[model samples]
Target chain A: NAGVTQTPKFRILKIGQSMTLQCTQDMNHNYMYWYRQDPGMGLKLIYYSVGAGITDKGEVPNGYNVSRSTTEDFPLRLELAAPSQTSVYFCASSYKSGRSSYNEQFFGPGTRLTVL
Target chain B: AQTVTQSQPEMSVQEAETVTLSCTYDTSESDYYLFWYKQPPSRQMILVIRQEAYKQQNATENRFSVNFQKAAKSFSLKISDSQLGDAAMYFCAYYGKGGATNKLIFGTGTLLAVQP
Candidate 1:
């Protein structure tokens, strides 16, 4: 099913520069999320969308923004990229609604970003 | 706030041996979900196993299994017959279904190395 896909597998950005990481899922899931994993650390949530046109901030929402116009696509925007923002970014989707749905999230290959 | 913690920063095991990676989480919600995600060098977040807090029985998938202790707030992953392919960074995540964010909180991760 091709599952979830992320674009630009890797990227390099200069301080103060801006870029967008693309994410899409073939599964018709209602919940999507953006997370960043730093070296020697676990992932921290950046943003999440419960459904189309619905977005909310997660644990680490600073320096990033997200837009969910369609159920399949949710893009993360990095504004004024800094060295601290350099990390592996992952996009995940799950059918996390209702009490009976699945809570397991399917993740993308991930995008490694380096900000200098 | 809910938090996930992986006490071990790194672990090593020989091929065909068994290794257990420990994970503990702090959450007030009684009903929640837990997961173990493996991130190989390719950086794909692969779900290894899952455990629902409400289910007393442990969850197992082939060589991978989980020990879910609700009272202790602990979830550990046991890998039997460890293969080189099993080497990766394992992350423990907690999902509080009762929370408003409905997001997964991840531990720092344990870097697993399988020696052949």
Candidate 2:
């Protein structure tokens, strides 16, 4: 099902440079999320969306913005990239949230970003 | 606030042996979900196992199983007959039902190494 897919497996950006990380999921999930993982560290949430056109900030949302224009796509845009933003980024999606529904998230193959 | 903690940063076991990775979480919510995710060198996050808080029986998937202790807020993953393919960084995550969006909080992860 190509559960979740990310683009630009690796990238290097300079200070103040901006770029967008692409993510797509064909599983028709209603919840989408973006997370970043630093070396030897756990993942931290950056942004998420409950459905198309509705986005919210997560635990670590600075320097990043996200838009969920469609159910299959959620793109993260990094503005004025900084060293702190250099990390591996993952995109994930899940079905509608419910008490009995299976909420297992499907993750993408991550994009490695290096801000110089 | 929900927090997941993985005390062991790294662990090693001989191939075909069993190894357990410990995890502890803090949450006030009674109904929630717990998960173990594996990230291999390819950088894809894969779901290893999951457990629902209300379930009394441990969740098992082939060679992977979880010992879930609700009272102690502990969830540990056990890899039986460990193989080289099982070597990866494992993360414990928590999802509470309090929020409208199902956000996941991940632990600092434990790196497992299967020695031949």
Candidate 1, B1-92: lDDT as tens digits: 88899999999999999999999999888888899999999888888888889999999999999999899999999999999999999999
Clash numbers, per candidate: 0, 0
At residue B25, give the lDDT of candidate 1: 93
Candidate 1 Cα outliers beyond 4 Å, as residue runs: A99-101
Candidate 1: lDDT of A5? 96
Clashing pairs in 2: none
Q: Assess the local accuracy of residue A85 in candidate 1 as a C-alpha lDDT between 0 and 100.
A: 98
Number of the top lDDT candidate: 2
In order, candidate lDDTs are: 0.92, 0.93
Q: List TM-score (chain A only) for every prediction.
A: 0.96, 0.95
Q: Which parts of model 2 are misplaced by more than 4 Å?
A: A97-102
| Candidate 1 chain A worst ten-residue window by lDDT | A95-104
List model 1 lDDT by residue over A5-102, tens digit each.
99989999999999999999999999999999999999999999999999999888999999999999999999899999999999999886675445
